[model samples]
Target: MNMSTKPENKFSEYLGNDEQGNMRLRLGTKFAAIYVEKGKDIYKETSKGLVKVTLEELVSKPWIRENFERERAFQRSKALAVGLQSSHIPLRERRAYKKRMGWVGAH
Candidate 1:
């Protein structure tokens, strides 16, 4: 397989709790969502109720996985901005400061 055509294995990164300790993903709109409880069990919201699902099944849908990944990235950026602001780091030095503090990939 060509490296350019190979899919990246980022499933684990998107399947965990956020900084806020919430293990949930909003599916497209707020009307639907997915929740993961302890032990990695997954559930999805439906017109009827929550339905159990497998991690492999969930991530197989490209759109669903893409949306989840996008959400996770947004959350991480928001958290990083908050952390830098709370630390009183200047905007100009945020890049250098994050690198120096070893937080660039600490996540």
Candidate 2:
């Protein structure tokens, strides 16, 4: 897996571009993610067969990003609390908290 494109640790979105209409994914973004809980195996069998998947997979047309929008969103969230905090608040709250935290581009 490419080190830069890999998820923070684990956990992925399994998504694709909105217009591509990838039947295998759910996200409108080009980036994707995959992860299992701290316990239990990440893989399980289903009608789709052995269910072989990985965190390295990009389900979209492959955003091919270097400091792409996904990273921008990540940075913006990091600059915000609701976005990066464990509280799971909405985007607005996160943005406000970012401003409070003095993140320059939080808006």
Highest TM-score scorer: 1
Off by over 4 Å in 2: 1-87, 105-107
Candidate 1 residue-wise lDDT at 44: 69
TM-scores, all candidates, are 0.45, 0.20
Cα lDDT of all candidates, in order?
A: 0.60, 0.41
What is residue 80's positional error in candidate 2, in angstroms? Answer: 13
What C-alpha lDDT does candidate 1 achieve relative to the native structure?
0.60
Top of the candidates by lDDT: 1
Compose the digit string of candidate 2's lDDT tens values, residues 27-94: 22343332222122232235564354344543342442222345446645766754356556776986
